[model samples]
Structure formats: structure tokens, C-alpha cells
Target: MKNESIQPPRFSSALDPIPDYLTHYFERTAGPFLNICDLDDEEVQKIREFELSNDIKWSRFKMWPEFMKSRKAADDLLMRLYEEKFQKSPAHRPVFAVLGDFHEIPCLYANPGSVRIEIADLREDEVTFMYPDHAHLIQFFDHDAPAFGVPLPENYSEERMPCWGKLFTYQDLHEIHVEYGIKKAIERCLNTPGSFVFSYVEAHIWTRDLKFTPIDHEPTGKCKKA
Candidate 1:
């Protein structure tokens, strides 16, 4: 008797659709940066086409541009919130902190203080932890890591290869849906005065036998021992 092949589930099941609130947030909060970078033309067109094909506005399609603008604003707003909330925290000082016993591997072909560009080589069994302030720490397993590319003056690349694996966060991951307005919600989250500690652990596994697991916590306080 022949054995039947098992197929993996669809991507939709693996990843939930972006909530309407987040969609609105993305449109309003991140829209400006996107507009400045000219990243919304194609997305806007797609939404329009979808609305026309479905023949249902329910709300209104005219607000698409406004939503996009709001989305871009959110990114900048989030950064400001992060800085304000944690800049004075003790954990925010060192950009990279190594846990356990490991040697600090200096870049072979690059300078320390010079413009260093790190790419998350998904191909390698390495994981990177990133903070809102552009700080990153890398943890590698018993594998040959890839080389880094030289930094370019103009037209730099922000492509990062995050370790292909599951990551767990300590903070509440809220998904919001908005039908019409999200400006107030965005403002509330962005401007509200409070501090939060976020933490995460990620497992980067190339295979069942070859894998690297490193845990990271946000807010720094979460990592403290009781």
C-alpha cells in the first residue's frame, strides 16, 4: 500500500487577517511616512478595486486616503511613545546585552562605531532581538553565520532576516478593528502617560537536530529575577 502525503495548512490559518482597527491605525498613523516614501499608491488602488468588485461600501471608500495617512502617523507616534516611556529606564542604556557565557565576536570586515548594518539572515540559525531605538542583539547557535554587507551612503537597505521561528511576547498583543474613526484611539495609545515592560523569547530552528533558542524580554524589568 502507498502512503499518502500530508499537506500543510493554508497561510490564512497560520496568520490572522489584519484587524480593521489596525488597518485603520495603519492607514492613519503610518500613512504620512508612507506617503513621504510613496508606498501607498498600489495599496490604495487595491482597496479601491476590492470595494468595486465586492460592490459594498457599508461605510465609505472616500476615507481610504485619510486612513492611509493615519497609519503612517502611528509609526512615528509609537516611536515617540517608546522613547518617552523607557528612555530613563536602566535597561535602555546598553544597546546590546549578552546573557550567559559567550565571547563577543567583533565584525571581521567592519569598524565598531562606523555605520554598522545587520541583516537577519533567515538562512542561518541565528536570532536577533530588536528594540524600538534601533538597538539589536544577535544570538547564534553552533552554525556558520553569514557575512554582513558593506554599508552604502545613499539608498540604504533595511532588510532584516529575523530567525525563522516562533517568538513569545510578555506584553498584551491587542488587535483592534475600526470602521470609521481611529484618531482618538491612536492618540490615546501614543500620548497616554504610562510605562510598560515587554519581553519575548524566540526559537530559531533550522531543523529538529540543529536549533538555537534564545529568550529576550522587553522593558528589561521582566528579565529581573524575583
Candidate 2:
């Protein structure tokens, strides 16, 4: 008997008949998403030195500020990139989300509530997608691992490579879908193992206070609350 080829997972596209929603995960008790950069240095330092019984998936990232001046600098870079692509400043700091159901993300809290926002609800111009997370692409942010865009193995096709170190607007994604079909375009960002693992397309929502529905708590058993 012949063995069947296993197909990779399929995700909804922004242009699909039934499109995917962007998911923002957070500690339900925290209320709304808070930008740490907005906090004073003293409070930020406390978080940086926060004690936890056990290490979490992104525990090391808490030390990231040691490599940079501050978290504000990082957000400035993000805003600069956003303005470079959109030619305008965002009204508020973006609320981050993943393109679809991507539970493998290492940065998620131990027990989190998710807010799902429909793609249709967001303006195409206000949403941007970044492959393998934007921080990995920051020139100054030391990845502390292999650089992105490391050549793939001999058998891997070049077309599978994502637009590394860049952001993609909704129209850009649409153009890619037109050329390669939505499945391949989605493949370009999803499950791509490079210097970083568990990679998923990150969506940055430029507009603030868009309506979203809260979902059930997701317990990943990855870490304890710090």
C-alpha cells in the first residue's frame, strides 16, 4: 500500500471567503493591554527584576532591556517602520495580535484570555503583518541566536522564504495571494522555523478601541504568573 502525503495545516486569509480573526492574548485580570514603555522607569525595573517560582517560555526576554536603552526606543523603531510603510503616524500604540490560531507562541502568559477581532472589522490600511515577530528583525536588538534569512537546506525551495525584516500591509498580502494563492502566502509566514521557532505572522492593529469579543481562558501550562 502507498503512504499518503501529510498536508500542512491551512489557515484563513484576510481575503478568504471566511477569513481568519486576529487573536490578542492577555492576563484577564489585567483588563486591557498595557504598554510597558508607558510605565515609569522604577515600575519597569520592578518588572524587569520580577521574581517567579519557575522560568517561563519568554522569561529571558525580560532581560532584553539590558541590551537596549529602553522599551520606548524599541517602540520608536516600530513606529518609524510603520510610518515608513504607511506614511502616517498611528493614532495610538498598536494592540498586537497573531494572524490566526497560533497556540505555540512562546510569549503567551500561563493562563490568558483572548480577544478575537474579525478581519472585516479592521481597516486594511490600519493592520500590518510581520513575519517571525518584528523584534527579531530590529537591527539593534540582538537576537542572541542565528540571524534570520539563513539559507535553507538544499531541498527547500526559495519561494518559501518570507519577506524577512519587513512589515506587510493588507494590500501586500493581497498581492501575494494573487501571485501565489492564499495558501502559499500563508505558508510564507506560518510555521517557518528559522533562527526563531514557533513563528507566526504578527498583526499590529493601528486603530484603538475596536470592538472585540473575549474568549475562554487558555491554559498552556508554560509558566507561573510573575
Candidate 3:
């Protein structure tokens, strides 16, 4: 008999064509793509509510209070994410956001200052240069990066992250299925870096049994940020 322990096939995307809006986001945005894995609109909404109810300003991050407050909120779905993953998450880590056009519904965000990174080479400073953090902004505007994350400024304000951009999302699909599209998007994002590969985060709803198929196709590149 053949080996009994062989695993079943990984998820594929032949059936799930990449939605138009999702592709458009990548094409329109200049930066290398950043996929915020395993979050849903309801939870994202709760996080936004948490931001407002607690007065979580851009520069303000007393994690303890935010933690306590989120814990107290009645939204179990939101706390399920926060209590475990985001409990110790510094405000510096950009918060995911939902935005849209007359076209798209749910776009991801990296709160302007939440993503900090080294930019000394990009600038001319004897000391290190960090934007989005030091400048109190994320520099998401007019970006052409293949992919990079800017840390939120230590003194950032919510006002700095402008709402308009080229972000698009697939609100139509169930959240679990969206993972497939995101994985494909990630593959496209890393392709340029050539040898670089990043971990594909398991979706919050992921389980061992109900897996989706991985799409085997190369990116279409139909979406352009301009």
C-alpha cells in the first residue's frame, strides 16, 4: 500500500479569481504591498471605535489603558484579536484601517506613524533618519517603494494619515477566503525582491482541515496606481 500519512493538497485559487478592486489597490499604490492578515471589517470597525472612544491620538499610546478599555468593550470579535495579538502592541505599530472610494469598500491602513524604519541612506544625516516617526508622519504619500514599513512617529497625530489613497479590498468575500487573495498579493509583492520570501501568516480563522487552494498563476499587473 502507498504511504498513508501523506497530506492533502494545499489551497488553490483557480476557482477564486482575484477581484478587480483588490488588484487595483496594488497597481495604484507605489509602495511595495503590505498585507494585514486575518482581520475583518467588524473587528476593524471596533478598533476604530476603540481609537475614538479612548482618544487614541497619533502620538498617544499608553498601551495599558487601551488594553483595559478594549478588554472592556462588548465586542468579543474585536477583543479576540486585541486580547491576544494586539495586547502588547505599541501604538507605534501602525493600525490597520478601512477606507474606500465610490469604488472600493475596505482598504488597509498603516496608521501614518505606526511603521518605523531606517532611512539614513535615503537622507543625508550623520545621524540616523526615521520618517513617519521622527517627522510625525508615515510618508505614505507620494511613495514609490517596492515595499517598506515606516514606524509611526513617536508624536504622531491621527490627522497626518490622510484618508485618500489607492487602497482597495474585497469586502464581498468571506474573510477566510480573502486570505487566498492576500497570499497571492504577497507573492507578487515579494517577486521583485527576487530571493526574498516572507512568512505567510495563518488567518485568524484558519484551521487545519478547511484549507483553501494556493493560486499558481503569476500576477496579472492589470491594476496601475496612476
Candidate 4:
């Protein structure tokens, strides 16, 4: 039988702008680091109330907590492994290895004192890298269009851009990973030297699906089943 999947809807520059309050809430409550350590019942309840009051679907905001926890746990476990097995201090290492195998990258061992390793939570379609003073949020979107395919007026760049893809459902993200092999691909990227940071690196990979779409034809219903 021929494949009959529906192509996911393309975001045009026509959608309504996301509210600033939602954006601020996400930034403050669902962080990659701070949330993991400081998230509490009260905060979660407050967010739940906000979402309900604003008519925002809870699913859109739910992943942040799980993603934050998973990433922190992974980082903690890896750090422990480094401390016990390598007997080396991560503080001494400024460069961090992400994805792939550390052995394949000669540069990794050459600067053990300067290298820290981390495995990202591929489930989280977005990652934010923050230092003591600087921060950057990297979002993953469909490869066919500009990162975050949602449509918005050009003038709405600052407001609309920040909200782009923040509305993506977890299922949408999962489909992207399945279709693109994003998780494994990122691991491979980490293994390859020069593909990622070599010193004091804070890298975020936004995995894009490689599937092709026909302009005139819509994807079959099967595609939407994912």
C-alpha cells in the first residue's frame, strides 16, 4: 500500500502573537538548570493556574519540567562518573564533550583537565545554555522552513520569534526525532572533533527532520498518525 500520511501544517506568518506573560513564565519557571533545583509545588500550581486562565494547553508547558529533571539527572550522573572513573576535576576542564563517543575524539583525551562530557536530553526539542552572565535559547524546528515554521508578520519578529515553536506539542517533537534520527545524529556530532566546541563549549543542537514535502500535495493521513 502507498504511504498516506498528512503533512504537518506549515506555520504561516498569520498566527496570533503569543502573550508575553507566557513567555516570561516559561523562562522563569521551566529552566534547564534553575528549575531543576528550585522548582516547587507552589510554582507548578501557579503555572497550572496561569495556563488554565490563559487557555493555554497544559501539554505545551508540561515537558519543561520533565525535560529539566532528565537533563539534570543525566548531567549529575555523568559528572559522578567523571569524578569516580577519571579521578579528574571537571572544574579544571573548560571544554565539554556532548553527544558521540569521547574515545573517537583524540582532542577529548588530550585535554582531559579541560574537558567535561554531557549527554543532552534529546526529548527536549529546545535547550538553553546559560552561564553566570550570558544566556541563549536554542529551539528545534522542522528543517523545511526557517527554524520554527510558524507564520508571523515580519515586524513581529521580536515578540513572535520568541514564541515560535514554543507551542509545539511533545508529539510533534517526537515525530521529528523519529523521522530524523536526531538523537543518534547529535551523538555522532559530539563524537566528531571540530563538530562541536573544543573549549569552554556550551553547545545546543537543534535537530531538523530531513523528510521532503511536495508543495501541491498534502501528506497522507498516516503521517499525521504519528
Which is the winner by TM-score between candidate 2 and candidate 3? 2
- The deviation in Å at residue 58 for candidate 4 is 9.9
TM-score of 4: 0.22
TM values, all candidates? 0.22, 0.67, 0.19, 0.22
Error of 4 at 119 (Å): 18
RMSD of each: 22.1, 9.1, 20.2, 22.5
Top TM-score: which candidate number? 2
Better of 1 and 2 by TM-score: 2
Model 2 Cα lDDT, one tens digit per residue, 95-189: 77777656544244433566677778778767787654555454434434333322323443336544554678766766664454444445564
TM-score of 3: 0.19
- Candidates 1 and 4: which is better by lDDT? 4
For candidate 3, lDDT tens digit of each residue in 1-226? 1222222123311214432210112212222222222245575455555444532222112333343223223123322333344243222222221111111101121221111111111111111111111111113332222212333335544344321111111232224334334444434543343212121211111111211221122232222222
Off by over 4 Å in 2: 1-19, 49-54, 60-71, 140-162, 177-198, 218-226
Error of 1 at 200 (Å): 21
lDDT of 4 by residue, 1-226 (tens): 1233332223311111211110001122332122322447677566545543442222323324343343334344333433543355343211122222222222211111111112233333332221100111222211222121112334644343332223222333334433433344344454354443221212222222112111122322221112
Cα lDDT for residue 113, candidate 2: 63
User: Taking the candidates one at a time, how many backbone clashes does each contain?
Assistant: 27, 0, 23, 16
Give the local distance difference test score of model 2. 0.56
Give each model's whole-structure lDDT: 0.23, 0.56, 0.24, 0.28
Report the CA-based lDDT of candidate 3 relative to the real structure.
Answer: 0.24
